[model samples]
Target: MSSDQVKNEIRRFLKSDDKLALCLRGKWGVGKTYTWDALLAEAFGNDTVSPQKYAYVSLFGLETLSDVRKSVFEHTVGAASFRETKDLEATFSSISERVAQLASKWRAGIGIIRGVPVVADYGGLVEAGFLDVRDQIVCFDDLERMSDGLDLKDVLGLISFLKEKKRCKVVLLLNSDALKEQDADDFRVQLEKVIDINLEYDPTSAEAIEIAIPNRSTLRSRLVAEYATTLGITNLRTVFKSLRICERLEEVLKGYDERVISQAFHSACLFAFALYQPNDAPPLETILKNRPYSDLFGNKEEKTPEQIQHAELLRRYRFLKVDGLDLVVFNSIRTGVYADELIKREADLIAAQLDLNDKDAAFTKAWDIYHDSFDDNGEEFAQALKQSIAENAVAISPSNLSASIATLKQLGHGEGTNDIIAAYIGSRGEGKEFWVGDPILPRFNVEDPDVKAAFASKAAEFADNRTLEEVATSIVRQSGWDNSDLDYLDQKTAEDFYKAIKEAKGEQLRLLVYGLTYFRNVGNPDPRMSSITTKAIEALQRLGRESEINRLRVSKFGVEVPAA
Candidate 1:
């Protein structure tokens, strides 16, 4: 039922003198209890509802009927008093008055000592207090989570007793889907005897968002609701969690532009759902990969149901990829701890880039030629793209620059692809190392061979500039080396290797020799390994033969120091 329909049903139940029990059932975390409580608060404020006393007890860990009965007595309260002060003090006073009244009625069961009644058992008094719990609206929640020791049949019997015997209005809230098979069967058998009305509390995405984020006037809440609706997230708990994350983002990004806030909010909504509702949303790893549209073409593999759903969700949200700011939002959601300074740092960078993009409206429009229309503006867009690349190529990220290059090449603008690559490379000074750890080209999907060759040339140039000391330090720092690092080492001659070892002393010399010996000990896995290890072994032998102290130091390593 819709939330409004459920509310009306509940209002009718409260207004009518129907002592029958109402069962509000739905999936877990769908706000069954939240909706019930909201309706109760409204009912408490209104004078049309008949019941003035209320009790809400969770059967989550209650193991027996007696435990449930004690809980009901403990939680009972007057609606008028609770609405006014929102405290249970009045309930305690009322319970005390009832207990005194019942104690007089049961005085004969107690033995009198020194003219005072001596009550040996308090269970009877508790039962008496519970017996006074009639004519009130009582809600039992989490019936599915009741302990195994508690029988479903017994709980249902108690609900029947509340409705038929005590003359109280009873409401049972549970996730029927969460019941075990046997329990479900048992509940079905017993539900007919106790429950007079059953309402399925499934709210739509908009209804749930209304229940979760009541004040949707704010931009943050509106964005959260928009993305949540797009993602079809109807779980109010997940919506509330997403809203909390957005609130944190808003607090950290208080003075930022709306566009910046909008980006963060959208990312926060997606990542929050991924974090809290993994079954309904994509996994965190998938989100972190930031490749929503990857592998769309050039592949013939069948997509799984989950993949198809995720693709649709990503398409609807227009979530092409995650950027630096999204990573910050993701970390905040995953860790549940916000680094205010880190968030602000990322937000500030995004704000600056947004401002830059705004100033370069032509650059933005150039991309819109591909995304915003199917018109024959190909020539106009191509010219604009090249112009933008010439002007703002330095500001664009490598991946985005490569995408633009690919787009240009697709439009028969292949002649200018090399110039764009050169401009981008020139903007990044030679001092900056384009290649680190590996020589593999970035998977930017740039199809032009010249662009790839340019990148390879840049990587090789960076590798060639590495001094032996820098290379050895890098090897030791990483504890190993890849083929590229070995390839760099392979370029050196035996005499050059000897010079590198000769320049080091003490621990540095030992560590450098040890790092090189790793390749030698590994049986030369790479073809360059043979030359590099042979040259390193020759260099170590040369160092050992130079002096008696060097011979002792090199011998301590247990490496074979061949004679010169």
Candidate 2:
């Protein structure tokens, strides 16, 4: 039933004096207990319910019938006292008075003296305490989590007794799907005898979000609610977690544009759901490693079930893109440690890029040829595209640049592609740092051969201009090398390698030595790697002859060096 329908039923159950048990059932973490408690609080405050007393007990660790009896007595409170105050001492005093009255009555009936002990043992106290449970409203929750020693038949028998023998109103809260197969069968057989009304408490996604985040006046809360509903997240626990993550992100992203905050909130919602509800969302490793578009269109081999599900989720939600800021959000959720400065730094960069995009409105509109309409405006689009490239080539990302070049070629404006490429390359400042290790070329997707040749030529110029020390320093700082670094190493002579090694000392020397010889330690070195290894060892051997410490350090590589 919907939340409103279930709540109306609960209100009716509260007003009637019928001696029957009601069962509220749902999946785990769907707010079964939360809903029941909120309704009870409302009923007590409004003075519209029939019951004068209330008792709520969770059967989580209760092992015996005696434990259940004691807990119900302890948790019971009068209606006025529930609305007036939540003082545990006052509630316990009321229960103590009732127990003393019951003990005195038993003593008088047995003709025992006033000073004599009426209760002989703890079992006597337990029985007398349970006598106060009659004619009051009681709720039993977490029935599936009760100890294995407590049999289902016995618990059901207790509920039946509360209704038929004691004349009390009883409510049971449980997650039936969480029970084991045999126990579930046994529960079904026994439940029919005791329960009069069984309400399935399955709230919709929006309804669940309303319960989880009631105060959605803030921008962060509204965005979280919006995306969570779009993703169809019905688990109230997951929604609560997502809200908490977004709250932290809001604090970290203070003083930023609303658009930046919205983007971060989107990432926070997806990452929080993925962490808490792995079955419904993709795995964190998959999300962190794969680009959404690549996952959708780049697979040539057969797709796995997980990949298919991920693609469908992305397509359904229209979350077909991600960026560096998303990675910051994912790490914050996974590690529970938000690097506030780093987050603000990323947000500031995004804010600047967004402002730039806003200023280049015509540049954005130029792409409308593909999206806005299809009225055969090829000539018009070509002129607009060429003008936009000329005006905003510096601001265009590599992927968008590739798309623009490809689009211009399609419109028979092939000659303009070179000018666009030149403008883009010229805007990149005069340094080799732009063409450093591992540029993401796959995302470029440029099909034009001339454009490809331009990028390759620029890369070669940068690589050739780089000195050996610059290459070694880059490798040492990152603690890893790429193919370009290996090619640079391949071009150097042994004397060049030795001179570079001879000029270095201390930690830099150690790191450079390790960087050069890393492949040798891993074994099955490539031929280029083996040649580099040979040259590096020869350099180290020459250096080792200068000092005993150097010889000792070189000996660790399984090479003995003679002292000078």
Candidate 3:
């Protein structure tokens, strides 16, 4: 039945003093309880209205008849009259007074013993407080979750007692799909013997979302609600949770642009839906590919019965497709690409505001001058040369002058670099900055072949003292090259290493290959070595030393050697 028709049936059932029981069955989270409460709210004018007292007791943890009675007593309000009153506390207080009067009257004729009443009726008064269900509406929810010790027959017997004996109107709310197969089979006979009416609740997707998410004024909320309805999300609980996540995203992304916020909304809703419907959730990669939920069923053969059922459920909910949301856009939002760009742009704006007060910006401005100068602009070249001198004018040792000059020479700006260095040294004449034996002197004098040869000799000498492992580690650290950082390496060094190992025979070669193993563990390289370490393997390949590479691949790196 539609939710409205069910509500109308309930209203009719309630308006008449019928001593019959109604069973409302649906899938979990379709808002059976909410619909019933809405009717109650309408009839009573307020949530706290005690008009025609009612008891709402969930059978979830109740294990016995006593537990059921206790729940009813705890939840029941006012008298059987179900009178119109908005004050729940006052109504309950009046019930307590009435029960106390009943207890006093029962004890009036009893004799006293040692100043104590002959009859103590505290439990009786508490029982008389609300145990009589006649003329009141009593609801039992979560019937499927009732403790196993409480048999269905016993529950039905209690329902019969309330209807036939007490003449109370009873409602039983349950998700029939959630019941175990054997229990469901058993319920066929027992439920029929008790309930006077069975109302099947299958709320439409739109009704579900509307009831689930009441705050639909915001654009994000409405978008999520509409998307949920389109996706065939009929579970009101899931819809409520998804809308809440969207609302939180709206607050978190308040200042973000619309595109970014919309992206966030889709991602957040999908994540929430995944949590709520884990079994039906599509694989993340499939979702990212924008494939329909129906695609989740394997095409290796014909669809299985379970797959067909899931497909039908998806069809019913309208969630079978990518509908109204693109996976690529959702992925961008999920991965924060737009947010990263916005952060970078914000950083640039802040740097502009800080101007020269930002040290990082000042250094960047210095590079801008060098960049323009290296591009063949005479005026920029002169300006860069002038700035280089002033930047190193304080007679500072290891100044920025040598680094900028080296960079300029690396860019093929030999004359410009020489001019900048000359002006910097002239400004620091006869000072420590112009030390004749300074380490920075050779690095800056790139135009001199002697200086270059001398530096190369020193580098070769350094490499000779350092083992291949140490060299590999130094290169890895300096270049920040991981195992995955492929396609880049020093060809000359790799070639030299290959030649060195080739000349070494027996144990010497084995020890030489041993150093490459150290790179296998540098900052988490799993089975493969780092890029600098892989350079060693490449060297072996260059010299056709497949045997050695194969041995090292398995013994040290835990990887199989690739086919030559």
Candidate 4:
């Protein structure tokens, strides 16, 4: 079910008193939280009571078992009139009591169930009091931490109590990729009434490319391919996390609350556009969010030297070289000296050897090159291919000159093709070879069978339009994000807010807000650091100087801040 459908289902779930949970699943950059907020809005109209009718809590730092109990206790305290609430006990009894009273209320919205900062047996206090509230709905965005380590006790208890005890509607927003196989399966089983609302990132052909510079498309392709290698992930989930792609993108992505989650999706988009766009830039008021950068995104693979090399091959291109240096790839693992020299000499090499292969002898010559490149050295060829895959060093698609791989295949390389195929994916593009399409280095050989299959999967997803979810789980590694400080799009992410003020009438565009919030704590920030761009820093300086805009309080965007 879509976010809207899930919103509608709340009423049915409430009326039926079904104990099943509503899990909104997808990958990061895919917008599970955004979908949840949309659902929440559908369930509850615009009103301050959004906080009162429903409660919103993030199990972000839920470290120990106590953290789990504490989160539940703090989030649901005001709903009960049980034993004097004080630590975990206050939460337990209060929650138990709240469940008893849930059926009595019908209205709903998100609100903190506030009581004594220190737990006290606090009687239930619904903040806004149901205003035409029909059924209660509770929504959780980026619920990665709360559901981990700890058993089905607290969270399950909360779920169990809400449905079995309280009879209120519940929605758990999650990027499916963040969820491991076990966790996802468990969640699916628990939600019982699972509603799947998969979404895609890249819009249709109708979705015009907003920013167009001279080589902008080329730049983006290179950068994306570069980031693709950095994350060592071909899936979309890794796209957003790619520091090369977004550069502390999560800084503007502020949100734990439902509506805010929706906004963060736009923030992610804003960062992408801002980085790629030229000349015009977004204002700080329109760009930054009030929340801290967070890792609520679950497990992600850390970029390694190899992956970095992978990124380099995808983005950079060589024109010509000085000496005999092979600087064909830059901004990757094997850059600098030799790499830089290679890039500098590419054009010259091609020109100098322009007559290396004569088109007049095309078929025979091309055939000879193919065989000489791989024929006898089977193991060497396989190893070279494997290196290509791992290094993101292979770009294949027929041929470059008049002789393309397609023509060769037509002539039948057979097992020679199969051996080449095995080397591509498993090796992750290790060996550097010829160019085909897109200029990125170590490109996925579309001709390789395994690569063909992987590309097919990506194409299928693209066809299905679910790139957002695809990005979420793509970079995942052993352990997921812990103690997430997510700020789903705050004021800065509301591209719609300043669109009227700047360029057009209601042209929504999120700019970088507090662009360095995630990086501020560093004493000596890296000028050539992996993530920061000189351009982004300049944007921050301009935004930060505006007193009127920077003076805005954190609360406006529904976020908490450190004391000055």
lDDT of 3 by residue, 77-128 (tens): 6443234445332345655565555555555745232243323554545555
Assess candidate 1 and give its lDDT.
Answer: 0.77
In what order do the candidates fall by TM-score, top score first?
A: 2, 1, 3, 4
Candidate 2 TM-score versus the reference = 0.64
Any idea how many clashes model 3 has? 9
Q: How far is candidate 2 from the true structure (C-alpha RMSD, Å)?
A: 12.2
Clashes of each: 0, 0, 9, 75
Evaluate all candidate structures by whole-model CA lDDT and list the values in order: 0.77, 0.79, 0.60, 0.36
List model 1 lDDT by residue over 1-564, tens digit each.
567898899888878776879999887787888888767777777765667788889998888888999889867877666467554434656666666666766665563322443244446677656877788888999898889899889999999999889889999998967888889999988988789999888888877777777887889788898889888888888888888888888998898899988999898888878877887787777667756545666566688988787777787888888788888888888888888898888888988887667646756767887789888888988888888877875466555676788778788877767877887788765442442323344534444466667766776665267677777777877776755677778888889878878888777876677766667567527778777888887777787888878787678767456665
| TM-score attained by model 4 | 0.29
lDDT (10s digit) by residue, model 4, range 207-266? 111111113344333344433333233223334333332322123222223223222222
- Ranking 1 against 4 by lDDT, winner: 1
Candidate with the greatest TM-score versus the true structure: 2
- Which structure among the candidates has the greatest lDDT? 2
lDDT of 2 at 147: 92
Off by over 4 Å in 2: 85-90, 111-113, 116-127, 289-310, 362-564
Candidate 1 vs candidate 2: the TM-score winner is 2
Clashing pairs in 2: none
Consecutive 10-residue window with the lowest summed lDDT within model 3:
482-491
